[model samples]
Target: MGEKESEKLLFWEHMRTPIAPQHPTLPKLLVLLILFVSLTYLVYTLKLVSTSRACKDAPFSKTIIAVNATASAAAVLRRGSRETNPEDRTDLRHLVFGIAASAKLWDQRKSYIKLWYRARDMRGVVWLDEKVKSEENNSDTLPPVRISGDTARFKYTNRQGHRSAIRISRIVSETLRLGMKDVRWFVMGDDDTVFVTENLIRVLRKYDHNELYYIGSLSESHLQNIFFSYNMAYGGGGFAISYPLAKALQKMQDRCIQRYPALYGSDDRMQACMAELGVPLTKEIGFHQYDVYGNLFGLLASHPVTPLVSLHHLDVVEPIFPNVTQVEALQRLTIPMKLDSAGLMQQSICYDKSKSWTVSVSWGFAVEIFRGVFSPREMEMPSRTFLNWYRRADYTAYAFNTRPVSRNPCQKPFVFYFSKAKYNSTMQQIVSEYERHRVPHPDCRWKMANPAAFDKVEVYKKPDPHLWDRVSSEEKLLQSEEVKGERDHGDRCGYV
Candidate 1:
């Protein structure tokens, strides 16, 4: 055969019968193995992703810092344990505090840090739109400046109105995404609010962080409660969201915010969002939004038996404690509270029909005891008198309410002021001394007709500065009249 024809025949022969010299199946088998492994990994990743989605909605476990975690506690029974690696009760971590500070007032966090922030053993982080760059090197601008203010657009949005809600929602997302997986309770508060960390933890201990808890107090004023639902916790007093709820909020908040564009306040917007999730405010009396401006003795004197968690509206009111500024009050609260004074001032308002007295105890004021228990048809100023030895013996030496009647200054007849008694003091002890007396007998009234002048009898007067001398003198005159009548009644009652 010719050479070319022979070469063609050899090529055809080689193509027809593949070489058995090497294993051709090896590379194909390797590719198949690689594909199989890749498929298995992809399935595993999808399962993990699905689990994480469900976990975001599942109830999460929490621990209190310094408070021991008990593994024996009943685990939160969730519906979908089908997760290959479910989070068990074995996952216990400390109480976590996530403070979402607005861009405008991040600097003012000093009060919180110095007061209650450092005392807590739990985890905490102040989430801000962006960290502040020190401007000490830059000349102080000719323009006025606040301690915690900036002009950045992002900062303003994070600190302002309904837009701030977006900031909070994002903080929750970022906080969890960046690995706060162990955080159980996420506490949210403003720049001015002061929390009693131990009391906060104590209060939180009462509830399971695993369950949904939107805990806080309502506004003290009816007008505020009218504007903001009493069902919502006033953010000034601060509020807590369970880890699960916070995560759930992270997912639902943006959509919720879109639904409520009219809500301009961060707190109210959050309330609306939580409402969408069917979570109502768990009213706790210990959280106080001292939304008033004046002495707190009157109200704090009557605090209830619950732990005091927070005090809001810092500089809005001064002298929250007797003779002390808001900062001073914050400092004082950090000191251990006497067990007897755990809950001093409660949100108490009651009218005694038998005695015809309308008594009320507020956060920063003394117990207001009014003679006519009935609500006024219209606002009326009943004549008011403030003079009694009892007044000298309270948390304050004198004034129970510095700004009584607010700026309106409502006066009532025989208005008696007394220092706050112990929280556990009986109703009898709490009432003003004049209130303790019943109507005088006819004979006693007649005898008091010859009411002696102050010069004629021994009397005690609260020492006052020249600014208060005139007012104090007038009060003394009222005291003289009331004393004589009381003396006549005492004689009639067989007292010496």
Candidate 2:
């Protein structure tokens, strides 16, 4: 065969195989199908690979350094009036009392180191022990050191009496990196905080050391029209920071300290620095920064009982004294009851009133009823005005009378429902009432449900019978005064 003819025949033979389609769209369709499959396979492969470090143990299983910054050494030595034992100066338990001192104003140089060592025997939870150094000295920054398998080296640097919280933070970041190269978390706190070891361990177990960084309360401040975002370091209340975040903070410490020099006096500013580093800050309601007083029971109930990490007592007197042992025992006993009651109260609000709403034997039942049903939507309706009279009248006449008012801040608003059989009748009554008068019947707009929709309905009895005794007496007094006024008016008219 000729070269040109053979070349042309070869091309036609390759193209004319069974794979060649007579239809124009079939090849295009097949190409698209193959491409789609290739893309899917790529995605599946990528999904199986995890990008983060996979530590087999708990995130905070590694040793942690707890740094406490106090105001002065004298404050540590002299127990305030609120101190449980004023005379026992040498006892280590007495050091927990100093957690509330105004370390900002005192000369903390000498005492901060002493208190750090004493805190080593803090309950049964000991993560690490390192000498506490005062931030007062102008020493070069050091890196974290590995002391042992279980114990890591740590340093508590006191920022020398409220000098600058920002500077202290920079010092803390620098100190944390000096001793441990791969610390899972770093804890920053004040002397006044009571550490809950078990709870701290639990929190640490939730995330990896690298994935987690900052653990605290998320807070933002609007001061003088300037909005500042900061995390409330439960860590400050004694929260823990992942090592990655701690290292990042240490690297940024110089820049942060220089940029916000005034912040050295503020704990929140130090946390703001961490936020700037892109470290995720997890806020814990369990870690409280406020004084323990008015709502002690409520506070204890709201927080986790078994895994409490720290308690910051700003008051001079210990709210529950007898040191750590007494506090632990009390918490163990009270926390469970408080949590149970809180749950019961939550369930009570959703109780179906159509069925018997037997109040639970617990005192929390009433609290739950108030929280779940009445409190949330009490003020939802608009006040009555002539222009918006319909809305006001309908709400006042119907919704208010049916649902109880809630007194708890966290409770959801109450709602009333009707059964399927009664739905039409109830709705008809509401419509009839609305047509005849300006105000509609209170039960008019309740949502209707099928009888089988609910497993049960609970009809609540009237709240405690004694609740209105004082109000009733006051009303009687007012009525008597009105009657007397009317009689005096009649007598004057007769005399005239």
Candidate 3:
């Protein structure tokens, strides 16, 4: 029991074990070191797991849904931006429509409106003059409007060509006063104007109602556009106002109308009012004002960079889709067709990677990429099929800087071929053509430039430097004539 005896006992135990007694301090240090290292490793592992989760949470932002996808198409085409999902959209309930029509056209508007509007959750009111009011019997969607001025005329006065457009202020003022408390946007368009609701919803989400925003695109008609204020949101093609801006307009609308007596049209008047409020026109590409007269074959065939929103003046123009009628185009628009963003935007021209079929808006210019993956055989007399690589179109030889690949019209793929010159076709017609053909895959690359760019754009023969190069236009048959030889051409030619 003495200290010497205890020491002697410890030595004997160590000797028996054949191991030195570990330092008491060393044991504590070793335990602490192990705990520290384990904690550091665990913290590092947790950090890596958090980063991976964040990437998974976001597939794509809803705001740039189609845009990013379309950009992806550009990348894939330019070997850049690739357009993905066909039917990505936000809430339609937040958007409301306002269709301005003549009394005579009220009945015509009702049919399509009734057909398409209900399914998409669209809420709208029809504005008609007193004459139409007298003519209309149903009176359900057509609200009774009371204009401040008497004797509304197509010609507001001899000096003004405003037609009934002079009534725009009152119409918008009334629409806001109608007490639509639910929706965030108030979209304005003519009765003849047709819209793609899914695209419309996506477009509306890009803006904020908290700001005073007026969104639309310019009229496609160069003359009409020049005659009118370039800053205006051409009413016929369709335009939208955020809830806050509409409320802002309502406050001074009466006075604003009184101030703009000399304004020639409703759009200009609206622009003037917006200017007073310091609101600028926010231009979007999807809206179309068919101010031009003629077939929109080339324009629709090329397809646009953005989603198709509205198309106006359906009566004057032929259907832009390859081979379809107006009535059929109207029907296809109401429901969801198995199409992607580019297809849904109503492009007349598209290339199916799956089918390799390239259809154009021209009368009968539909061609398929008939190259088989396994065979890679050339047919002296081929049926329908295109080269699979074209199923993934490489570069759209645009007429810009000839900079290999870019959606930038001025910068690259300098062989601008698609026409930006005009658009007369309704968005529906383009959709109809694609639904039947479904030409291009959503991810396939497309080159849209001035149609003039295609002047010498024939795919060059093999063993020729002109392959996909700019060549003389003299020997080449035009796209119109090519339609006639499409079947024969498919047998002979490998290029689009």
TM-score of 2: 0.37
The reply for model 1, stretches above 4 Å from the true place, is 1-93, 133-162, 168-173, 336-496
Candidate order (lDDT) = 3, 1, 2
Worst 10 residues of 2 by lDDT: 429-438
- lDDT, candidate 1, 201-304, per-residue tens: 65665567779989988765545566668788777787877888888887877677666655656677788888899999998877876554444443454454
lDDT of 3 by residue, 1-496 (tens): 9999999999989878866667589889999999999999999999999876855655657535656656655544531111133233235666667777776666666554543455335567667665543535444433343333442433344274645766654566777777876767888887778777666766765555667889998865444556666688888888999888888888987677677667787888888889999999999877877554445433443335466777777776665433566655556543322232223423222232443333233211222221121121121111211111112222231111111222333221112122111112443232212112332223223443222212222221112112222212432446335534544344433232
Q: For this target, which candidate reaches the highest lDDT against the unseen true structure?
A: 3
Give the whole-model CA lDDT for all candidates, comma-separated.
Answer: 0.51, 0.37, 0.53
Would you list the rank order by TM-score, best first?
3, 1, 2
Q: Where does candidate 3 stray beyond 4 Å? A: 1-90, 131-163, 321-325, 333-342, 346-496
RMSD of each: 22.3, 24.0, 17.9
TM-score winner, 1 or 2: 1
TM-score of each: 0.48, 0.37, 0.52
